[model samples]
Target: MLTKRLVTALLTAVTCTITTAAAVPAQAAASTAIPVPSTGEHLMPAGGVFEAGTAWKLDVRNAPLHANSAGMVKTVADQTAALYGGVAAFNAYQYSTSFYTVPADQPRVDVQWDNCQGKNYTPPGLLGPEGQFTQVPIPADAVPAKGTDSQLTVYSPSTDQLWEFWVTKKTADGSWSACWGGRIDGVSQSDGFFLDGFGASASGLSLAGGTIGIEDVRSGVIDHALALHMSAPGTWQEFSYPAQRSDGFDTSVNRVPEGTRLRLDPSVDVDALKMHPIAKMVAKAAQKYGFIVTDKAGCTAVVAESPQAEIAATGVDPWKQLMGSTPSYSIMKNFPWGQLQALPRDYAKRTVAPATPSTDPGTSPTAPTAVSTRYVSDTTFRTVRNGWGPVEKDRSNGESAAGDGRGLKIAGVSYAKGLGVHASSEVIVPVEGAKTFSAQVGVDGEVGTNGSVVFQVWNGATKLADSGTLRGGQAAKTLTADVTGASEIRLVVTDSGNGSAKDHADWANAKLLTPVATTTTAPTITAPTTTAPTAVSTRYVSDTTFRTVRNGWGPVEKDRSNGESAAGDGRGLKIAGVSYAKGLGVHASSEVIVPVEGAKTFSAQVGVDGEVGTNGSVVFQVWNGATKLADSGTLRGGQAAKTLTADVTGASEIRLVVTDSGNGRTADHADWADAKLLG
Candidate 1:
């Protein structure tokens, strides 16, 4: 679905920001200038089939459509003579097309699209990653509501899916009237989505947002050149793209047939020309990586990047000054059309074929096996099962809602939580066997409330919690309930006073955390409470004796003995970072087995390495399998030694475990010096 240049976005790297633009070029000689090849993953020139930045495709679209001093093709002149009898047809009217934009504040929609049956040719395969689209919405303000021009582009970070629409018409019922479309997998370099040797209007790989974007202009530099279009000289029905012939069009002769490639003769120096700055940019691009034919448009015209994004990228308005009166069109009208040459119809450059990778075009990225907890969005009711109403539009007061897992935010009142104002929604708890229910509540929307709102959690008739009389200004109170054994949970919000008055509430970042269950079976045998008769005050064991501790540090670490072997105090055991029982992020653990008899207490000193900003912490605890006996609070990377002791009245197996306070193994270097089991 992601057609690079077909719809929106600029022609620059996806993440580059704007900087002072460079001046017009007197670039090094063509042979000396840094070559910017089109064959790389930067999808451009419609016929290309690469992903963003990997270097996969090298077909007719990216490779020099036809080698200049190397390859040959059926010249545009030869074909024109066989059809319209020559230059008359070439000089026939041709004009560039303009794109309109929708303001950024419009509501985005999950497009409902259908094929323009019988009108546009249907290829054997589908376009784009093969997934049944449900939440597939158009990118914010993807198209101008009134712009009759149908080409469109859409991307959903939530699903990592991008869609391209062509010859489109949006019906009032929220369905698409499209002549044709294609979809591509964003991650996989090559996918099952089909491609025709004869490229379509949006045939260029970079139709959707790719390397070159309007953002590049804002940065004052066009990293790449533009992709333009031309007509096949004759009405010849033999189409080069997915579909060569369609209903209502005359099939007469072959002219600038679909998929034809053209480039400015390398001999013509763009740097030597004196046209508008914009026109010069376009010409130089043609000389190097020329544009390919995508669609039949208002003559031999080149479409620029998304107009909306072009303006927004700058955060200023230089559109008119940069584009000029006719958007550089008047200037291009005089470009060297005669110097252009076309690439062969079906071109491929491979001497030895390699085994192609297997692909599954129809599957959604394997959905993470549903864990116990889930964040049920306030929009869709599919997961709620009961008590959700149609989405409402309330912009003014609701707390601005955060985008979903995908970085997408809609306009209007975002935090207006409810099924049509004072409404309710129910979601199954995260942990199926969880013994607790937890969530955050806030009257976050615009606070037009002298009126109040009540948040209640219920499992059938048994009420768990009631956040009473909450107003917008006093929101974000946390609520907890022991909802043990309940099959499902329901969260209800009711108006405390008069019918709901601007009670846009919020349920933010709620999670149902479940710890790994450990074996609680008491030990069969017990060790002495204190060291054997000759305990000799104390004999210590390194944490490495009981369990595997951190091998070293950093992912690249390999030498285990390199780190501090003992704590700074030099009395007890030393180990790597601390981590939870299972693992937090990195793997870290410390434990020791020692014979003891009536050992009264266990104490030690712990902290991360003495580095500032190391982001490490440790939790030293004495445990008996799943049960925790003593904790050393939380020690930071460089906090002063804090003494901790746990009474081991009738304990046999005394084990120590250091857990990472936050992320695993960043600054986790712990020591249990000055530690012993006092008898």
Candidate 2:
């Protein structure tokens, strides 16, 4: 989340159409450049604009491999010394394998690892012998009809190499294959090894719709790379093709915590959807068609009727119940559905149809027969046992039995007659021997007015405590009154002395005092703490530079106007007439640090306002003397915060500025803001 002031500032500064992108380099790949547009004569590299459906592939099968079974060991022994020396003798060959899917409906790509078999002592755990692989599949009934990609990068760690892959497209015969190739090889094989490489445009294959696969294919390469190294156990990671596909639990290594799930409030947050199109689609679908659980086998099971039959009995189209036309359901891996479980049949008068005998003979005749014998029962109740009741009931008119013996005012501005002030008048069951009262309060209005609603808990006639008014309608709060062994409880609402304005308060869900029986202590309450870095002194002059930086008013600085200096700094700065330049250079040698602790990221804003420029951008960087720490992003005139959130450790100096090294612009607007850290 961003701070209120920071959000406002960014929103104001970056009002023009802005675009962004991100890319990470691979150690074994060739240099890659963003393609720029061609002017009337000169051709320029693209800045950050990538065509929406552009595709690419990454091949992992062409890399190293091990075996899934042990029988292949003898085959390598026959020619172990012919290729290298004793190195290939005991090589399990299976230790360097990738996982691939053989689905029932699709042809699987055949991979050959010998293409990547090293001719020298490349040494396992040092560099990789992985290469790009592709083959058309032959249609055969014995082959699985379908296949999915698998994650093969997991083996790279054991092999002491960095590996990555992407599925690009299928051949006419349906064999899936990768399109890019790169490897970081020739290093000491050890744990925690790290390397960096760049994937050229050819290596930018997108994994958007592909799976990573691993297989055993090392017999031909066992003795090729070394003389005495032995193989180790090989493991492969799994990649689900459809982004929404889930197999029981995610196990993807990138899975979100089990307890925390993504939730978007549609009414107040529509922009979040734009960032995660797939998740937004799922959310919208969940809201439209009440969610159906996916089985352990990854199959979505349609819900014939809601577990809460009473709600289903309302004749509400489950699909139409969605806030919009989107469907929603809880995504659970271990959901239990042996027999249907529904709560007591309670109605909202208009919420559901009145209980009527099921015309179908199979509909239980015995259940209704038992209900006719009593208006209420003492034993535990189930949904089928209780019939739908009236929505309106006679509730105590602000009567109270508190120690003070005073009646509290219960009526107030409500959204509807049956709601709000009259919520208590609706049917409410007294929890036998309950000492507290609970109610669900919700608001739908701007933060200010929504935050002003006052909530209170009362015992009969006396006001025991004020639960505090709800200020925002976005979040829901459960208010409870503490009073042991009480027979009844009341909820009180006040408008804060304001008149006639109903902010759409919905009190449809309310219940009388009921305490959860527990001998254990109640959940502890704690407040979250926020931290900020302290301010630093010793400001340097001309310590900032960039391609450019701008604000809402216009360009703050264009090019490196401060001229040459021992260091990069810009304390007192002004803009130049140039629209874009090579880069912003600082005059002061010293660096300025921005505090960003307990924050997920840091972002910098640069460029001029109102005017568009070609190759115009602002990049935030952290440096340790001459060593660069991080490069945040290329800025656009009036662009939002593009944060640098990767791990930042042992960084001493930080700077913010802009540059247009790749392409030049003619607009005379640009400037920059110190990087802002966000949690």
Best of the candidates, lDDT = 1
Candidate 2: residue 643 Cα off by (Å):
8.6
lDDT of 2 by residue, 113-137 (tens): 2212221111121222233233222
Candidate 2 stretches greater than 4 Å from native: 1-428, 431-487, 490-591, 594-616, 626-679
Question: What is residue 590's positional error in candidate 1, in angstroms?
Answer: 79
For each candidate in the order shown, give its overall lDDT on alpha carbons.
0.38, 0.24
- What local lDDT score does residue 506 receive in model 1, on the 0 to 100 scale? 47
Tens-digit lDDT string for candidate 1 (484-539): 67766676667675566555544432334332222236768666788744442443
Candidate 1: lDDT over CA atoms? 0.38
TM-score of each: 0.35, 0.19
Q: What is the TM-score (0 to 1) of candidate 1?
A: 0.35
